[model samples]
Target: MATEGLRALLHSVRYEVLPAKASEEKVLAHVPRDVVVTVTASPVKGLEPTLDLTTRLAGHGYRVVPHVPARLLRDDAHLKEVAGRLREAGVDDVFVPAGDADPPAGDFHGALPVLRRLGELGSPFARVGVTGYPESHPIIDDDITVQAMWDKREHATYIVSNLCFDPRVLGEWLVRIRRRQVELPVHVGVAGPVQRAKLLAMATKIGVGESTRFLTRHPSWFLRFAAPGGYAPERLLTRARDALTAPSSGVAGLHLFTFNQIAETERWRRALLDRLGG
Candidate 1:
């Protein structure tokens, strides 16, 4: 039987994007109309690509959330300008991250500072999201990362975890959050079904710092599962689904890292939902 909790959780799935050409149409076609779509700001493509994509998606009536990488914002003035653009496009939510840019482009070096500036700007966003790591980060210690979450909790409306392959770890992390009294809703990050080689190539091409951090933190898992075979996110999701639907879990939804494999990811999601009779 499909539980109400499962249905509610499934309805909250969101798709992630790389700011590539034709990505807007591709993602919109693959994702359900009501699902929130987030466009990532690539270091190579910079923020403009994501901004442009978000504007286009919003115009088409999709709930679009663009990532505002702190390093890319030149300063407070630039931040205001960006907020204005988003408001004009009808965007009322955003995901703030520290970005992969090597050096600080402005006063904000991390998400907390940029989030503070956004608060000061009095933007009209209904919700603001910050990244969370269930696994350890490459450079930041666990204590520092956890403290960062506590600092951001006051400003952030939700937490979107970085990608993780282990559902037990994610479930335990959710428990930990509740124990710590951090009640923010969480969006569990899961990569969709993608070919191993293709995923690896795309990761390298995109130059994502998070991928490096993930590999560093979970070398054994990466070595074992990320081989030249088809990879399925279902294994992880299935293991986590029960915990995800637990009343006390506080995990709100899924954040799918499509890796631009929109078609395959959509297929996987639909199949899973169908298996769940929803």
Candidate 2:
């Protein structure tokens, strides 16, 4: 039954939250104990918030994965300090990304360099996640992005796809990954049920500059979805579910970008799961 499948899927889902805006108490209050949670590092806000949030989350007994944006790290020394702090907080997993910052902060321009440094540190985390673009990235070319993942696979435990609306793109991308011999399991990204207007407004307010690239790549689709009417992630999920259920697909799970709309997201997830008989 769908409910059984939903329950199974829930065990693997990781909910993402912005560390800068999410309060420890607020996060703890909203996040269920069973779901794994990840804190994102904002390029503009720096890494302190993520560190603080992760520490608190770990203290509360939630499995926490903190983002380590390459542009925010200053050097190997900074990396060591961050790792030390995370270890002290009983945190392990991390999601390393090239980051949206315009200029390089130090020696690491991308996740590969930072991941290499983490490897040298001999951290204890069993998992390390890297970003993947199921659709075209805003800035990087397809070839470059593909190579980046291939290069990071040695150090990364999984691939979490960037947000995308098209399930076909995701499905085909997964096939391509396997064909190319990039074997890391994938966590498909989906925005939780969001109001179209709200998504657009938030998108603009957040100054997600890279979104321009997404828009450029899919202008018609973007425009159609940008206007009134709500946005349901089901269309994408339907496709992802098929891929995930396939024996040879190698898809891992879902990474819900809740956009700090925790209550609504949780409600939707729970309702859907229950409907699916989870």
Candidate that would win on TM-score? 1
lDDT of candidate 1 over 1-278, digit per residue (tens):
22556656666889898877768779767777788899999765678888899999998889999999998888888898899999999999999988777677778889999888778777468899999888877778876777788899988999999988778988888888777777889998887776666767666766567567445555654554565564567667667777888867788888988888888878877777787778
Q: How close is candidate 2 to the true structure, as a TM-score?
A: 0.89
Q: Give me the runs in candidate 2 sitting further than 4 Å from their true place.
A: 1-7, 200-229
By lDDT, the best candidate is: 1
Candidate 2, 53-90: lDDT as tens digits: 99988999998999989988988899889888998998
Model 1 misses residue 21 by how many Å?
1.2
Measured over all alpha carbons after superposition, the RMSD of each candidate to the real structure, in angstroms, is 2.5, 2.8
Off by over 4 Å in 1: 1-4, 207-230
Clashes of 2: 4
